[model samples]
Target: MIPAAHAPTPARRLTVEQVLTGRLVQPLFQPIVDLTTGMVVGLEALARGPAGTVLEFPDRLFAAAIDAGCLGALDLLCSERSLECAIAATTPPPLLFTNAEPAVLDQPLSPHLIELVGGGLPFRQVVEFTERALSAVPGSMLRIAGQTQRWGNGLALDDVGVDPMSLAFLPLVEPEVIKLDMSLLRDPDGDHTRSVCAVVRAEADRTGALVVAEGIETPGDLDTARLLGAQWGQGWLFGRPAGIEQRHRYDASAADLLRPARPGFHERSERAYDCAVDAATPSVATRAEVVAALSRLRDVVAAHDTAVVVMSSADTGLPGVALSLAELASSGRPVIVLDQPATTEFVVAAIAPGRGCAVGLRTSNVLELVTVDDLPTVAVMARALLNRHR
Candidate 1:
């Protein structure tokens, strides 16, 4: 356990509690302007804490929330407050952009939040998330991505070019707004910049999604934003963040609703249990086929260091199955080859958080295989099995 002296101070802890329970944080809106007409298209609501405290700034505010183990609560509180403020504005903007923490994507929200989703905000709400937690919390992220679509809210990937995972999971995220990291525009001549631009352009071309360049403080930065294919932009060049109640609200044409979250996820319909991309009747696999599938599973175990395996008891008799399981176990992954043969006989491997998995079910035949892929379904199935045994 951590020492008391090392813990957050009494005053700091009290500040976090006061901020969350009392909803004392302030919401500041920064306009997202259209580059062509220089018109306000949307407003991104940023949260600030109470005055004269360490929590007044966001960096310290969120860090304090994280230390208190109430980051999720703070996130929900901020979102709720932001939504309420946007709707209460004299003239509601067309789009309201708000931040969402990646780790909170899967947790249940309060009834107030659910009701808010049902009622819909004054404007089409766009929730922004960073790819920083994509690998750390993928199961929740993927489910929320699909859920956000079902909720009729737009999704934005912020600080996209700062990490490789951003580009790697771009397809999975399928965001409507790509908020390029500020650094990309500040120093745009690097090889990495070209790569990011190419990918962003290709994605925009394919999806017809709008690009928003962040931190465009100067005319030069505005030019850089245009060169990067940004149609919408946010920075001091447009306007500083001002509160809704403040008299600094600008008048611009109401922008249309941003694109809805794209389809291709199965969880939106199936919810918690069924996560299959396609539910096809299981088919039998011959000895050669079973061996080949096991070989692939072995490779998956090798590649994904944290992947866990749940093998069918029947598959234990297959050629080299014992050796493969031994190798997987020696690699220190939590592997289980069931001893009892139920109606299903399959070899399943899943990485925690559902980043990747290999799933193949089996039956009375050598294997009652349905499919194999890196879909989140395998992760869901593996988790269900793990729970049942526990």
Candidate 2:
């Protein structure tokens, strides 16, 4: 373990008069990166020490800040200092993420403070709001939300899956991003975490919020998060939190970080037609022939890291269609039947032909599969089909 000196100290009890002096404020930075690309995205501003004490964790420091009635001042100071430091560095400004208690946000900071930092630095920044603190001041949530929106800084709802109370604030705050805590992701099969993640994902989809799975520690954790639809990920698996002066350069070119967790289906969907044209034999109509076509198509999709699979089959009226596994199931086809030769045409028609339902498509699926190359054309085709049938 790192020495205790590196850890943050809790604030000594101080009078409200002492709080305004801002003497106790010191900001530390924890780097956030793109898990897929391993590129440093930005830093999370964490509070460090008050002159003397033995506390080292950010959580304790923040709690003491609240108790000392200096949380607002501390938050503002951290935001200002963190941004200034990032600008001085040669690295391109990544989005600076900071935590703001709802109580702090409810208090109005001089517009000049926001203007000063924003004017001097690149405006790519996100302020994460702690859900527990927000819940404590329920009546003022909307006001805080409006202020954050007006400040031109993006808002993120943090600690999403840990507390049940977070669900109540989702509609009221309408944050631009939602961060799922690592604890929730520990067990991929845990119903509570999965259910909460599903709800959070749905809210993100509805509001166009970016879902970030925070505190990722292992490859398994990363995989589970991606499978559950988190577009962005952060954790020890990516990088650990280093001190403010530390210049950490994340190598963004690592393919594992950039590659989608499920590449096979998405890649196949993108080049479904191409794979079909190249791999399928003309005279074959057996189950093995169809399975081989699917397998080859899966390989093509995997190469591109896509999530949807399209195949051409001779069974149904629609010879060519894309079918997501979910759609195939919902179409009332038995799993056995779906694996049978006759169901291939129906599956393709449902998914590829842009059938009546938008059942199986997901945003993560789109982001993983749709590249600059052929996304526009594929999108046009999908939309045309949706519109034509609607």
lDDT string, candidate 2, 123-222, tens digits: 3556677876543543344444444545455667898877654653454445667788877788667987877777777667656777788878888887
Writing each residue's lDDT as its tens digit, candidate 1 over 1-390 gives: 889889755433346888988889888899898888787778899988876677888888998999999998898888888888888888777778888887776677777877887686667778788976454555566566666777777888899788744664555465788899998997799887887888788777766678999999999999999998898899999889998764434434443436655543413322112343254344666656666766666666666444445544444454534345566544535434342333444445544222445545544535445555644455445433433331
Model 2 TM-score, 2 decimals: 0.54
**Which ranges of candidate 1 are over 4 A from the true structure?**
1-14, 245-257, 261-390
Off by over 4 Å in 2: 1-24, 50-56, 118-120, 248-390
C-alpha lDDT score of every prediction, in listed order = 0.67, 0.50
lDDT of 2: 0.50
